[model samples]
Target chain A: MQTTQRPAVSEAVAKSRKKRELIKNVVAYSFIAPNFVGFAVFTLVPMVMAVALAFLSWDGSTNNPITFVGIQNFIDLFQDAKFRQALINTVAYAVITVPLTMAASLGLAILLNQQIRARNFFRTMMFFPYVASMVAVTAVWNMLFNPAMGPVNMILSGLGVENLPRWSVDNNWFICMGTVILFSIWKFMGYYMIIYLAGLQGVNPDLYEAAALDGASPWQRFWYVTLPQLRPTTFFVTVMLTIQCFKVYDIFLMITNFGPGGKTRVLVGNIYEAAFTSRKFGYSSAIAMVLFVLVLIVTLVQFRGEKSMNE
Target chain B: MKEKSGITGGRIAVYVILILLSVLTIIPFAWMLSASLKLNKDVFAWPMEWIPSNPQWANYINIWTKIPLLKYIGNTAILTVVVTLLQLLTSSFAAYAFAKLRFWGRNLLFLGYIATIAMPWQVYMVPQFMMMSGMGLNDKLIAMVCLQAFSAFGVFLMKQFYDGIPDELCEAARIDGLSEYGIWAKIMLPLSKPSLATLTIFTFVNTWNDFLGPLLYLHTDSKKTLQLGLRMFIGQYSAEYGLIMAASVVALIPVLIVFLALQKYFVQGIASSGLKG
Candidate 1:
């Protein structure tokens, strides 16, 4: 009877412990429920809908039923000339802006890292553009890019340069892309510079001191020591800048409005015009799918790079 | 003496280059200010007026009266504040679960959240609009707020901070018979103030300056945000450079104030996020 009673007591204790564990799980899940639910409803569900919508035709109206068109949306998108232009423009923008911004920011970071007067002030001023409203900054750039009476052209002609391109309004695609890239580099470099500055803080100072003690010139020290030390930061900045450049929309919208005849259209801008202007929800989703693939590839590459670095 | 002179030359060169770059960076802003104070005709004057001979303070007043600038600003402020607070609440709660909780499928859920961080909004714009409209949330401020409130990036950021904290603290609180909610509210929230501040600034700025979200969701002029309002103002009054610049300046003031007040946190937030610009 005593042995049976002992077994019953142990069983009760084990059962209570299991109940407590279940209760703890409930509490933990309850804490996550609100946010996770919202995320699922808003983001996750919509993402799934986007992928599905790419294969279906919908005019984005309540009356029109979503029709399954299979691969026709993507097939049409591939053949569209404007989509091709947007693809090229987006790639061009990324190709030009990412490296330029990276180089400029890294340069500024190195300069700021030096023993300089009013370093914080310089850093803040450089970063001011990043925090400013894009609408406002692009509006100002619009005025600056004014062909006839703009300061840019005025300064260029003052330097005795003849036949200046109309900057943002230039019919040439490269010129239009260049204007957008210039604005991007100006706006984004400061933020990257701050990242590089933080990266610089992590680099062991003793290495630099040792390089100097080895009679290494400043340039050699920078090339041999600083560059290798900053490889991780450089990689991170490159990936981020590439991703942002692909999504470039607002500046082109405000500055060039696709440049004379839709010359400066980008992937995001194309999606916006397709969905909002044309009201072709299916077609826009197809374009978005292309963008999604591009970004996913870049992100995957970054993750693989990070994993290797960690190893 | 030669080495000291060489150092002085290098220092001078650095100062010169930095100052030159700073001036170049500031040129557009300075031109905006000057143009905001000039008359419409004088705004595009040749040689570009670095200073307005006669300042037109009335452009600011005109922006207010010509359009619903104040109302747009109010809408933006309300949306920004609400969205920022909601993101902080949701993100911190979700982050706590991801960081401290020992539950089934925890790592899997976190990985799902991380996967979405790189997914651009363009991918879901059309579908999200449809979903919002289906839920009768289109053209509503609540739509924008709800859409932005749950950010994977925000969760990831706060989780990184939370992970740095020792689990022993939470265990100790649990041993004291405190509930998980109690531990979160009492122990977690108090310790993660810096991360909270960083997310607050980031969400506020992003929401405030957001153009595409407002453009898609808020169709009515009355519900328009500052960025959308500024865009509309530019569309209607592109030729009126003075008034446009004045409106842009007015729109920029709040962001500048927030940035100036919390510049440190902004930098920290970006650095910690590792990918945010």
Candidate 2:
């Protein structure tokens, strides 16, 4: 009788444990439901719709239905001159802005990491532009870049320079692009400097002492010891800056208003115009798809690089 | 004595360079403030008045009168507060499930969510705009609030914070017969104040400075946020540098205050998330 009761009691315990596990699952699901549902409705669904809409021709009007035209939108995008220009402009912006900003911020970080006075104040001053709104920053920059009456040109002309290009108004793409790049560097350098500062903290002081004992000059120490140690941080900054550079819309929109006849038009600006201004939903999605692919490739490369670095 | 002199010289050079750069960094803001107080005609004066002789304090007042500055500020405030609170609640709840709960497809769901961060908004901008308009939510602050409230980045941030916490506490609480929601509210939320504060600072600053989101969603003049209002203000009063600078300065105050007050958390939040990425 005792042996029979033991098996029955064990069975009852297992069943109760199963019931508890089921209840726990329900509670977990309930905790996740609210956020997950909102994310699905807003982000996940829209992403899927974007991919689908890229292949269809739609005017975004309810009177017309989305018609599937495979590969045509992509083909047309390649053939479009404006799209080509935008792609080139965006690449140029990233190419110029990324390395310059990185070098500038890394330089600032190295200086601040020294036994300097008023370090915190310097850091705050550098970061102030980043904290300010893009609209406000660009507004100030726009006035500074004002062709005739702006202080920037005034300073140049005061210094007896010949023929100041109308800064942002210059039809020459290079000058306009340069203005945008300058503003981008000014706006973002502080934020990147903070990242480098954090990276600097992780470097062991003993390594510096060892280098000093080996009769390394400050320049050599930076070149040999500091730069190598900052590889991971540099890589992270490069990836982030690259991604951000590709999505450079707000500055262009506010600073130059597409820069004196679309000379500085970027991929995002193109996509904005196509979708909202021109009402070509399908075509705009195709441009966005190209952007999506470019970003995806960059991100995947970074991940692969990170994995190999880890190995 | 030679080494000491060399070190002193190097230090002096560093200070000079730093001071110079700091001046360059600050001059734009200084110029903005100075120009905001100057007469419209004096704004472009060459050797530009670093200091306005007669500060036009009325430019500040004029900006208020020219546009519905108060209305825009109110709109921005409402969106920032609502969105920040909702994001914290939703992100923390989802983060608790991801960090503490046992579930199927958890890792897969999280990967899907995090992957969205890599995609720029341009990818889904049109579709999301269409979705919002279809629901007749376009031009409404609540729509913007709802759209921004569930950030995958916020979830990822909170989850990283939650991952630092030991499971022993949650297990102990469970043994004490506390429900999962009770554990989340009473145990997890209380302990994760630092992460919450970091997320709050980031969300508030991002929302306050946001231009594209407001530009896309809120079309009506009365519904515009501060960023959008400033943009339109520039377009209309492009010639009025004094008023523009004053408006810009006014628009920048809240973010500046937040940054100054919470400098440590703000910098830490940026560094940690950035390095992790």
Candidate 3:
């Protein structure tokens, strides 16, 4: 009778297996190595350099040397009128954009969550603008707001309203701000609507059905059942909106460029102008440093908020 | 029954309101097209001519004359395709490693990659420009392609996709004596076809529409992207409105075509990225 013997994995065989595992690891690291090298050179090195440069003063021209001035940049920034204006504008933008974007997106999300007809078509239609080139979208806005031969003025004329405000009129600060706010909201609402839709999809359907059978009205169901379920999504969206609003530059650049005496100038635009245009690299780095800290703090708070929510 | 009817009425009201909101979103693009169809004299009419009083289909003809849009299209297309292709090659390799190949400091290294996306380009603007200038890459298309190819988000995006795949597939391939590279090529890649399509479309659109990077890096007017080229089309004369709008319409078409084709995955892809803002 021939006995069936299980062949053992020999010592040489085990070493070969181990060598193959080692080779797999080496291959993995080599693939990841290039990205890490790039990130370190670009992201990490620059980040440290920015923080260090914030304490120094340099004209940013190739000829100049950086003069070490501890805390003076930050101190001078508080008293600087442009800095003050930028801070106010940034904060005001956050206030206007954050709440309104959330409310609009939420309202749209709830509207979309319903048993509606041709929903995906409407969803796509809304999202297309967000995806449209800034050049194209801004041009449309520019033409629409143009005082002469523009549709906005034409619509006003039809209603017989004389001297209607040109939305992005030069040197009119509030009007320019109003224009920025309107454009931002229009561009964003669709993107957020999708997020809300995703959040809506995640909510337990049976919860709504049970509430309905219990004689809960649609509004009641949304307010209690839907809103509670969506709180995390709302929090997530709010954090994202804050980051994006703070980083507003593309639209500002494409539009009047914070025109009418730098009234609409945002922090990112300010950083660009300071470093690239005016050759004030130290000060620009200073501004960037401050902006980075603000972002860090806000993001940390969001993490904390999420942690608490999970708890 | 009256209360129930009222509730139903409210739901209808919500849908109507949402639909109206969606229309307002599209109305601006519609007006742009409509205005582009008008004659030079008719474009700026006070009553905001809904349909051009005198339809000049020649506005489309005039785009070629006003600026070299076809060259811009060629430039943007060539740059976007190169960037997308390079990004796919690099990102997929790294993503495969992160997903299937467990090595030392794997988690730490992946964390390092995600952290790169948080740093805005403005932070790197001057240094990157300086680096490109030093390399004598100024006024060159390759600089634009390279800048976009060294993408942090692409790696992160592809990793998330690779993670969705089952590890058992790779393990089974391993037991059959297939190499790690073989498993990635044969199994993981085929499973993530939809995701790669999503990434391709997203990366293509971003590289195409991006004006700031090209505006900064691309010194020569000839090397400019479509969006930048569209800006060059604007003349001091308001009479150029027809031509300008026509150019804008031209720029919008390729993106719209892409959107129409991949939109199902596009919307879901964006939402899945946890970057809704």
Candidate 4:
């Protein structure tokens, strides 16, 4: 709104309004100060520093002075075999886990959406793994997947399977990566299932009735009505899962710890290993920059997709 | 009659499949519990003893003795409570400003929060660790508390809920000469209970389960949380599967109780805000 200083009385009213606006601003800032201050210190500053640190050389020690080495870390990172492998592993884990989690969660949501007995019980049970601590959850799975003596192999042997793939102990990358992906799917699918259940509920029942009236079968109704209605939810889930998969460290740490020769090491695990274990702050920040850019691109795409959908 | 009977059969079949899937979902945790009770050798006995003839009640006792499990739990509890309480207060307070108050740069500031929420902490954890270490907060539980005390996601979640609140309520409260803080405290806070519960659950669960934060910040044995403690226990006593499972069970009970008690909030919160811990 444009303020016109037409005359003395009008000028006085505008001045008072401006004063009120100032008071409001002060009050708002007072409310926001506490969280914003902590946020700025802990999260915002570190984020900026991370970007800056990526272009510098620092061993994260007091003796070594930080030096500007623009793009050198990136050059070194690209040529590093461990970084390359971690990048591939991270991408592979995300690529495999995201779609599978989405599908399984969607299917589970559809199943639970039916007017069945003890719906909440089933929902709670499914979502239980997500709430459980990753350390505990992975510990249990480690025992279950313990190749030489775990129940998984024991059951497999009982089912007339001669060759067990030696679950986590196997040197094969596929076995390790596959187990990680499967665990990822199980742990996360329930959370997505809840989101999808919400989406499924928002779907108009009238659409199903209309489809049925038009001679559509159950699968057809689901394919034609349910899937389309869930596009936004699915989009949200995919973006969340993608972002999550990239940051997956706890599961890998507990289950594999980049072991069996770093076959299952992820981007975050690499960043951790580099920064903490190797004390290569600059190189690690460079790796972090790659993660940041990947997530930023996904987020930008999400915003764009959301805007288009809203339009 | 035929169609009706077929519908019954279909319903029964769906029920059966759901029951089976539920069992499949629970098998791992059930196995954990079962293994926690069993002797290590019997835990993986052929055909898998679903129930041990004699439960190893001693393994549970050994966990507390072998490692400082109680201290880890105490550390985790303190951190979780403090972080959750602080997050709720600050995030809700900040959210009220973002949602209800008209101010310069309000939209831009809220956008900052949204942007950070999308950026995973892994991207900046190294710098964060460096900053904390530079401040002489290394190997301190206070560092983890400070790091997690403020959250963009919590603010975003609360703001979304607050945005739904009728402006007229605040206006009426203002007419009654209630200060903005009073309006937030007496009105907004009370009204945003569901969101508060949601944030509490997320913060509590996340803090309790957090591994990397403790792994990075809290290096001392005395300050380690349950996740770090359990991991260390595993590394040290890799052969003692029974004790490990027992400790894992102890670690899981708090979260399981929290989840089961207030699970509706989990679904409602996620459905409304689409945020997760």
The alpha-carbon RMSD values of the candidates against the true structure, listed in the order shown, are 1.6, 1.6, 4.1, 2.7
iRMSD of all candidate structures = 1.6, 1.2, 2.3, 1.6
Q: Give the Å shift of residue B245 in candidate 2.
A: 0.6
User: Candidate 4 residues A1-311, lDDT tens each?
Assistant: 24444576688999999999999999999999999999999999999999999999888878889999989999999999988999999999899899999999999999899998899999999999898999888988888898888878887888899979776657898898888888988899899999999888889999988998999987899899999998899899999999999888888877777888777678999898888888888999999999999898889888888989889
Question: Candidate 3: where is the Cα deviation over 4 Å?
Answer: A1-21, A37-44, A56-63, A66-70, A170-172, B1-15, B235-239, B275-277
Cα lDDT of all candidates, in order? 0.89, 0.90, 0.79, 0.90
TM-score of chain B of 1: 0.96
Work out the TM-score per prediction: 0.97, 0.97, 0.92, 0.97
Residue runs of model 1 more than 4 Å from their true location after superposition? A2-7, B275-277
* Per-candidate DockQ vs. reference: 0.73, 0.78, 0.52, 0.76
Give the clashing residue pairs of candidate 4, or none: none
Candidate 1 lDDT, B1-277, residue by residue in tens: 9989999999999999999999999998899999999998999888666777789999988989999988999999999999998899988998998999988778888888888887888789789998899999989999999888998988898999999999999999989999888998999999998888889888988999999898899999999999999999899888999999999888888888888888888888778777432
lDDT of 4 at A258: 85
How well does model 2 score by local distance difference test? Answer: 0.90
The TM-score obtained by model 4 is 0.97
Scored against the true structure, residue B71 in model 2 reaches a CA lDDT of 96
Model 3 preserves the real interface contacts to a fraction of 0.42
- The DockQ of predicted model 3 stands at 0.52
Best by DockQ: 2
Kindly report the fnat of each predicted structure, to 2 decimals.
0.78, 0.77, 0.42, 0.89
Which regions of candidate 2 deviate over 4 angstroms? A1-14
lDDT by residue for model 1 over A1-311, one digit each (tens)?
99889989999999999998898788778878888998888999999998998999989777989899999999999799999999998998898889899999999999999988899899999999998999999999988888888878888988999989898888887788888889999999999999999889889999999998999999999999999998899989988888888887888888889867888888999898899889999999999999999998899899898889779
Cα lDDT for residue A3, model 2?
A: 90
Better of 2 and 3 by TM-score: 2
Q: Is candidate 1 or candidate 3 better by DockQ?
A: 1
Worst 10 residues of 1 chain B by lDDT: B268-277
